[model samples]
Target: MNATDPLLTVEDLNVRFPTRQGVIEAVRGTSFSVGRERVGIVGESGSGKSMTGRAILRLVRPPGEVSARRIDFMGEDLLSLSEREMRRIRGHRISMVMQDPKFSLNPVIRVGEQISEAYRLHTRASRRAARQKTLEMLEAVQIRDPERVYQTFPHEVSGGMGQRIMIAMMLIPDPDLLIADEPTSALDVTVQMRVLAILDKLVQERGMGLIFISHDLNLVSSFCDRVIIMYGGRIVETCRAAELDKAEHPYTRGLLAALPRLDQPQARLDVLERDPAWLKEQSVVAHV
Candidate 1:
C-alpha cells in the first residue's frame, strides 16, 4: 500500500442484535477511514462508539450480527478472511486496548508473564527474549521499576499501573493499527494525561493508525487529529479536531453546548435535545 493510502477503510458497517422487542441496530451504516493518525469517535453512552470499534475487529459475538460492504486493512479485505486468517491479523497486526484492565487482564497470572505470553504468541520468541521485550515495553509506557511490577498480579497493581500494563501487553507485537476504547476513562486526571501521553508517543514513534473511542468531547478534540461525532448509532458530523466548535449538525452543537467551560461559566449546562430525524439522516462519512 502507498504511504498516502489509508491503513484501514470501513464502509457501510452495521452491527445489530436481535431481542424480544425487536432487532436493535447498535451501529448503522457507519463509514470511515484511518491513516497513520489519531481519529476520535465521540458520543453519549449507547451511541455505538464502542460497537463501532468492536465491529472493526469482528469481535461482536454470536446472536449479534455484523455486516459491512467492505472492511479493508492494509490493502486486504478483512471481511473475506477466514476465522483462522483473522486470528493472525488480530493481535499481531491489530490490537485493541479495552476500557477496563480489571476485566481484560488475567486474574491468576503474573503481569510480566502475561505480557511475555502475548509477545511469544505472535513472534514465537524464546522465553528469555520475550521477557526482555516485555520489560522494555513496560518501561516504554512510563512504568517505573518494571521488574517489581512484572512480578505483581493484576489485583496487586493500582488502576493506573494496571492500565499501563494493559497497554504494554497489547503493544508488544507492534500492531499497525490500534483501537483504544476509552482506555483512560477509569483513571484520575493526572493518570489520564500520562496514559494519553504514552499513547501519543507510541503512535508517533511507530507510525501507526489509532482509533480513539471516548465520550469526553473536549478531551477528544484536544488529543485527536480528526473528530467523528456520532448520534443514534450514526455519524452526525465529521471535521478537524480544531474545527469541532464550528460543527453544523444540531446534535453536535447540542453536545458541545452541554460541556461546562471554565472560561464561560453558566448557572446550568444546557441539556442535549435529541431529534428522531437524526436516526434516519445519512451518516457523515469521514475521509481521513
Candidate 2:
C-alpha cells in the first residue's frame, strides 16, 4: 500500500441499543479513516469516541447493535467478517487498550502470564518463548526491572505502571492497528507523558496505525497527526492537528474556547454551548 492509503475506513457507522426506555444511539453516522499515523478522537463524556472504537472492533455485545455502510480494514470488510475471522484479526492484526487497568486486568493471573497468554494465543510461540516476549514487551514500554514486574499481580503495580503493562500487552502481538481509549487518562502528568512517548516510539518504529480517543483537546492537538471532534454521537469536525485551533465548526470552536490557557488565566472558563443543529451536520472528512 502507498503511504497515503488508509489502513482502515469507517463509513456511516451507527451503534444503537434498544433499551426499555427507548432506543439509544451511542454512535450515529460516524465516519473516518485511519492511516499509518496518529489520529485522535476528542469529545466530552457521552460523545461516542470510545463507542466508535468498540464498534469498529465488533466488541459491542447484544442489546447493542452496530451497523455500518462500510468498515474496511486492510482491504477486508470488518463489518462483514465472521466472529471466528474477527477473532483471528483481533490482537493479531488489531488491538485495543481500554481505559482503567484496574478492571481490564485479570486479578487471578500474574501480569506476565496475562501478557504471555495473549502472545501465545495469537502466535505459535511456546510457553518459554511467550514469557521471553512478554519480558521484552515490558522492557520496550520502559518498565524497569521487567523481571520483578513479570511476576507481580495487577493490584501490586501503580496506576501508571499498570497502564504501561496494558500497553505492552496490547502491542505484544505486533498489531497493525491499535485503538487506545483514554489509555493515559488515569495517570499523572509525568506518567502520561512517558506512556505517550512510549506509544509514539512504538507506533513510529513498527509503522502501526493508531486511534487515540480522549476528552482533552490540547493533548490531542499536540500529540496526534489529525483530530476528529465528535458531538452528540456525530463527528462535528475533522482537521489537521496543527490547525485545530482554527477549526471552523461552531462546536469545535466552542470546545477550543473552553480550554483553559496557562498564559491567559481567566476568573471563569467559558462553558461550551451545544446546538442541537450541529448533530445533523454532515461528517467532515479529514481536512486542513
Residue 62 error for model 2, in Å?
1.5
Per-candidate total of colliding backbone pairs: 0, 0
lDDT of each: 0.88, 0.90
Model 2 C-alpha lDDT per residue in residues 192-237, reported as the tens digit of each score: 8998999999999999999999999989999999999998888988
Off by over 4 Å in 1: 265-288
- Flag regions of model 2 displaced more than 4 Å: 267-278, 282-288
Per-residue C-alpha lDDT of model 1 across residues 1-288, encoded as one tens digit per residue: 565579999999999999999999888888888889999999989999999998888899989999999999987898899999999999889999988965699999999999999999999999999999999999999999999998999999999998889999989999999999999887899999999999999999998989999999989999999999887888878999988877877677778887887787663435545554544564454343
Model 1, position 14: C-alpha lDDT score: 94
The TM-scores, one per candidate, come to 0.95, 0.95
Please report the candidate that would top lDDT against the real structure: 2
Worst 10 residues of 2 by lDDT: 267-276
Candidates' RMSD to native: 1.8, 1.7
